[model samples]
Target chain A: MAADQLAPERDTRAVEAGLDALDGGGELLPPRPGPWQVFVRSVLPPVVFMAALVGVWQLAYVAELKPSYALPGPADVWQTFWGTVQDGRAVEAVWVSVSRGGIGFAMSLVIGTLLGLAMWGSRWLRAAVGPIVSGLQSLPSVAWVPAAIIWFQLTDAAIYTVVLLGAVPSIANGLLTGFKQVPPLFDRVGRVLGLSTLGRVRYVLLPAALPGYVGGLRQGWAFAWRSLMAAELITYSPSLGLGLGQLLSIGRDLSSMSLVITSIALILLVGVAIELLLFAPLERRVLRTRGLTTDR
Target chain B: MTQVREQAPTRNTVAPPPAPAAVRVDGVTQVFERGRPPVLEGVDLTVAAGEFVCLLGASGCGKSTLLNLVAGLATPTAGRVEVSAERPALMFQEPALLPWLTARGNVELALKARGVARGARRTEAERLLELVNLGSHGAKRVHELSGGMRQRVALARALAQDSSVLLMDEPFAALDAITRDVLHEELTRVWTEQQLSVVFVTHNVREAVRLGQRVVLMSSRPGRIVREWQVDIPHPRAIESPAVGALASEITAELHREISRHGR
Candidate 1:
């Protein structure tokens, strides 16, 4: 009779304790929101802000706030953009700019990585070249355009030279800072484990410095693209196919406002697409793995 | 109160019975000039094969400096320090497990560095983890494990080196009391089973008494060995038992005396 009476009470207390454990000791389930909650939380505000900006732009255009040449309407820019695409020159111009940017960026990545490694590995090399690298980074790539033209005689080589000058320093500086930030704890750990110099570089230092290196590459690509455009605009050669910069120059010379707007729009679009599609995602993933990003 | 065991005569001890001295430091002096006085002076100690020794001292006593010398991460300015076989494995105060690697991968890295055979590496790493009682945590990332679990993985990594001598610099100092007590028990069990020589450095007096067969007390600022106590208390020492408490008090008092002398 006593056992039967106690059993139910004991079970009830056990259930209560389990509930307490769930609530107080461990991570509990978060309260769920309605089906449209996330959409409301994430999507609504951004859409409203964009709509507001567009409304303001349309109002300004309707008010005749500025000359059409100086500030084209969104409709005019869109029409110019669509017309270029329909005629197929926009596609060609994009291909020309991207190929140049891609090739230049790839070359910069290799050269910069090697130079950075050299600077990091040797004290004498770092002492000799480190200051020069910093000085080069500070000096604008446009400053190299005159020297590059003189050296390479207004060809693709000139554009390539300017791009290299622009991008290499950013990449090298990124890696140098990254190498410096690697904690001493890792080096000690490597030494204790008897990692060879090569093994330490491969297994520890490189992996630790990857995020910084990737950041450098991203910066270098932007610099390379900018330098290429500037060089192409300043040193127009018929032999070199018309890139976006060349197309913009042609539009300006001919006073075709629509063409000018179209080329400018294409440049901006390509830059945004590269950042959004590639480097941003890459950086986010790296940061998330390192716990540098919040879970949410 | 249980009677504390007195030290056996040094002469009758017969030089710890001629077993291989896994780690031998003879008149090791480390001097650091940080624009100041020397840091360590004439510190001599040894760990016999399979013996567990603790170097106990206050902060700034160069205990960590001494451990660094043993680990070969830093060279001593003066005197001979030798590990009979290979480079001794080291454990830092923090878990120091690479954040990028999982628990098992951390151990595998040590094995790889030691040039363990590819075919044998996985099984050997698993065995080490099992010895540390973390057999099921092989797949867990370093950050996912609790502090105690991380230390256990570190212990497994140290074991992966296959070094007869293990030098630990207060590996449990950061842990909470309960976690520390559990680890102490775990360490004792692992050390017994592996029969590896250990040189553990710490400031905790009871911990020194609990885990060490011999506890060497070091004095500060150009640290030197001032006292050596050989604990003969039986396995699984009860921290609150009269014997453990009495010895701990004696060591604590001796440490206080050494610290006081530094004012002179």
Candidate 2:
């Protein structure tokens, strides 16, 4: 009876002790991967896949699948690529395309973000422009090249117009998606904290919307690069300078299959390089910080 | 059994207490949309400085709406709500900590919002985290911490605002029973230590009895305070203790009766 009477008194103390045991300095998250692990995960697989693809292409060449002119061997393509590299033509072609893509993408980012903010701020604006933006995202940038050339001529202006049309809607819609996904409770939290209207948008809304915006930027870059290539291919003139797409078109006029293949490979390589060097790291950092990455 | 007592009539225009109250809600009526019934009608509540009150009722009782009104997140449709000077800090059922920020960064954001200098912000955030027994875990991400720990960080962040009162809307309702019980003790300790006027809203009867100095029960359908109980239990009272259980059961019975009335 005495022990029974005392047991109830000890329950709270027992619970406190149990809680202390449970608290054990909290959970330990996995350590971030080192540079070598990053290389194995992100770099190695692509290198292996590309090497195997080239090997299969060489085997098909040995088997004599097509005429040597129509289907050039890997060695012929490599020789063409190497010659262009040695003559500095490759660097100039890549730089022209990259610089155009960079400039066009930057302008798109700014305009798209502003458009998204305007839409978020006003229901009328969102209703008016929202569907048009979605429709633009689905429309191929290649389709806009003819219209752009007619509007702005065969100068860089035509290429840039196509690039802007390709990228802006994707970026704006990305930001809008980000803003929409933000939980309503966050706004209430901001209000209770006495944050000013600008402060709430700056500190709460923008940060909440970042992951979506970054996804938008990545997609925008893809669209701009594709549109830039399409514009270059169709709008080539003597004064317009030789981009990768223009180099490929020149190869077509001269009937050099290997040169065309080399130019196409270079264009693909540059797109992959920009995505790997710039956007991949940025996207990883954003997702990791937000605990949206599964590795955490 | 402690029988339910009749609510005192609304006493607006009465002389103020010698010590100023932290919150004053006078005949608050909230209608979210036109031509619909009000969410809260003529609901009046007052919290004195350094007091702990729990608003207890079934779902749709406007307890959360009432807390939002007190927190100034939403304005009452008719009645005036007055907070004695400083803006009250509010906590939601979810932690609401920014996922981009670490637990410490979340607290620092609040300090920054309050215009705390950059030089002192870090140490002050640490001190607040320390107050919640999460000093060493401040560097962890929001996802890294356990559910109970996240709520503690939230409490720390709310404390960072340096508000006179804290409004909590079912903050611990999502946690497991054991964790909730542990948090109850942690909350009571912090409540006394901070000397904050707290208006805690919850549906749990025992939770109300465990932490509140006064438990106010509200009836739903244009929510109004129907009865109030002053918990005379001493400090550090266990949730399983007879005193808490007795008051909790009595309140639970009344709550059941109140809830049953809606079925008919």
Model 2 interface RMSD, one decimal: 5.6
The runs of at least 3 residues in candidate 2 whose Cα sits more than 4 Å from the true structure, single-residue gaps closed, are A1-44, B1-18
- What are the candidates' C-alpha RMSDs? 7.0, 4.3
Candidate 1 lDDT, B51-114, residue by residue in tens: 9999999999899999998888788888888887578899999888876677888899899999
Q: What DockQ do you compute for every candidate structure?
A: 0.18, 0.36
**Alpha carbon deviation, residue B243, candidate 1 (Å):** 2.8
lDDT by residue for model 1 over A112-208, one digit each (tens)?
Answer: 9899999998999999999999998887798889999899887889999999999999899899888887888888888888899888888888877
The C-alpha stretches of model 1 lying farther than 4 A from their native spots are: A1-48, B1-18, B34-37
Q: Candidate 2 lDDT, tens digit per residue, A138-226?
A: 99988988888888888999999999999999999999999999999888888888889899998999999999989998998999899
lDDT of 2: 0.86
Q: Kindly report the docking quality category of candidate 2.
A: acceptable
TM-score of 2: 0.92
Ten contiguous residues with the weakest lDDT in model 2 chain B? B7-16
How accurate locally is residue B51 in candidate 1, as Cα lDDT from 0 to 100?
92
Candidate 2, pairs of clashing residues: none
Model 2 reproduced share of reference interface contacts: 0.37
